[model samples]
Target chain A: MVKLNEHDGSIISVQDVNFYYGASKALTDINMSFKKNQVTALIGPSGCGKSTLLRLLNRMNDLIDGTRVEGRVYFEGKNIYDPHVDPVDIRRKIGMVFQKPNPFPKSIFNNIIYGPTLSGAGSRSDLSALVEKSLKQSVLWDEVKDILNQSAMRLSGGQQQRLCIARALAMNPDILLMDEPTSALDPISTAKIEELIDELKKDYTIIIVTHNMQQAARVSDETGFFYLGKLIEYNQTAKIFTKPDLKQTEDYITGRFG
Target chain B: MEGTRHTSSQYEMELQDIKDNLIYLGVLTEKAIASAMDALLQRDTNQARKVIAADSEIDRLDMELEERCIRVLALRQPAAKDLRFITTAIKVNGHLERIGDMAVNIAEKAIILNAEPQLKPYIDLPRMAEIVRNMIRESLDSFVNEDLETAEKVALEEDEVDKLNEQIFRELLTFMLEDTRTITRATIIMQISKNLERVADHAKGVADMVIYLVTGKSVRHQY
Candidate 1:
């Protein structure tokens, strides 16, 4: 059993972590730390294990049979992978938004309250207040406040994604994990989400995986470059985009990579 | 390690074009300074006039290079080293153009001095021009090869040119005090020396930008 040491300024720390899918190894001895209230972007070409690493943060990989994670992933001084710890409780504290908007078939109001309601958040008045607060935090309050009862499927792709973000925020998690949250949306919508990311970071630590390099540069405070399941470089976003220390990082960001 | 081409060949070509044009501009300014000094030494007004006439070409190339840099910045949206390279190229282009203008300043002064009787056999001014020309060449070479040593050498050469400028100034001051008749020609020669010194400063400026491009750290105004 790993000791439950007190965490430093970082909210999450991954130490000597290796992940495997069946017999195929995915991530290798990865080490990183995420600070509180910062937007950290993970970027690279596809199949770099950036998405795998994001899912691993909240124990999202535990749902898949034969997928195994080795080493310690400490959240708030506790190793989340310990057998005694609950995976459901770890996930509740680290909510995720997917690449595509996946609102439930139900109305927007119910979508926000689904997780809290399952945990037995009773009373009609309490659920309604939670819905309004989450929607406003995701910057969707003005557009959808009047149409709270409407089906989520009617919203645009960008709105639907923000609605998903609101749904994630409904749990009042300390950390938000986003996997390519803006890739499916149009430019204007992408801009809005990027702006929301800038605003949300004041209250939440955001870790985003993005294929779009400009979006990573625009939205992230720090950036980590991943390649072939290995972490290449992690640095301040300005440093990563302007003058990375490693040649491999420079090659990838400058579009000179093989 | 030395030459990794951009995956976008067009981007590779765009960067190459900026580099080639900068060297061409460097060569033009070098020739202008050489011809203008030769015209003064040999008292040849025609060569001075030719140097003066070549100024328009330098101006045109400077504008063209700036436009290309801006286009690359907007269209390609380059990052990391490519971003540093483009920004450096823009600055180097401006320095080279200013060097060309200084060459023109030297040519105009040469025409004035050539009209008068020989100014003290034109010894130090020609040496200064030669050193300034070499500074321009080495600075641009440093940029093309991304060679830090060559850039540092250019900066040291700039110091040498400055020393030569001061020596020439003191020597000409004595000539002016000895005879009132030599004042006009000696003043023009002094103006030419000052212009050559400024040209060396501009070359040093190019070398400084090259340093920033290669290291991605600004060394400007620090020395």
Candidate 2:
């Protein structure tokens, strides 16, 4: 197997991760690692297994009946799919954000505090401080501080997406899995989330799955181009954007034969 | 790679337009250098004036090629090889335009030298001019064909032009030293040789950009 990334100190290592939806193979022998505190973007067309690969990182695929994943997904150092390992615990550590803003029908404050509350978090004042810190980290505090009690659904599409990210951060996760986190937002909103991702990578390892090639280039430290359930090429984002070594990767990004 | 056609023919044609304008600019600059050499060798002031007048076309093409490159960068958002090619096109466009200016500089000196007596047969200078013109032609051809061998060949041939330039300078210095009356013509001939040397340098620059476009390895400042 040719490895594009050689990060020795990987936070999450996916080795021969083959996933299947009943008889159909969704991912074929994916071998990659998300390094500590670095943003890795998975880019490809629809049904290319980028999102499936992201879901495999946090074991979100376990919930889907008749779906199976064969191989190891080591988070920190332990294989996440090990019999002794708990998927719920894995989910708590490797938080995920979806394509559309799926904030609960609760208030903005509730959205940030919901994940912490589920895991027997802190006292009333402690939760409030946690909410404030998470909102500030996600860069949504100033816009929504005065309206913390407002329904999260009332916020704009961009703000809702940022709220979703804030909700994920509130879990104090070591890694963040974003599957098309900015696809539903407008350009301005997408730019804000992209900037937030840049800042967030200082402390958290980010593995984003985006269909937007330009956004992947703009935000990720490394980019992996997947085609037909296989990682065609992966390299530094600058190399991927300006001079990809593989012709398939170049053709896809430049829209020659995507 | 050349056989692989872009899905969007308009974008492909826009890229091809940059290449076409670049080659056209190369042709005009090559013509300018040849005309300047012809004007100097035959002592034709009218031919030198024609070389000077024709440089505006290269200048205009330079602007057009740069604008086209910018459009592809802005609108098409070219990636990988296309990105490399457009950047190479813009840099090569500048080199060719500067080469055109150097030809005009040579033409100006040719007009002045034609006013006076011949500068003792003009052996190495015309040879230098011909070598510089071939360098420009080959450098552009290497870029158009994505031919690394021709690009490397252009870089290798530059040393000969430099050697000729030095020989011409040393021979003319002896002419100036022997006869004080010949100093004016000697210096003009020396200036023409210097301009031809500069044209060779610009051709080498184009060759370096082509090498980078093909191999993504910069060979500039290495030679």
lDDT for every model?
Answer: 0.90, 0.89
Q: Each candidate: how many clashes? A: 0, 0
Evaluated on CA atoms against the true complex, candidate 1 attains a DockQ of 0.84
| Model 2 lDDT tens row, A141-190 | 99999999999999999999999999999999889999999999999999
In the range A1-258, model 1's lDDT, one tens digit per residue, is 222336555889898999999999899999999988899999999999999999999999998899999999999798899999998998898999999999999999999999999989979998999999999999999999999999999999999999999999999888999999988999999999999999999889999999999999999999999999899999999999999999999999999889
In candidate 2, the residue pairs with backbone N, CA or C atoms under 3 Å apart (3 or more residues apart, or in different chains) clash, namely none
Docking class of 2: medium
True contacts kept of 1: 0.86
> Lowest lDDT 10-mer window, candidate 1 chain A?
A1-10
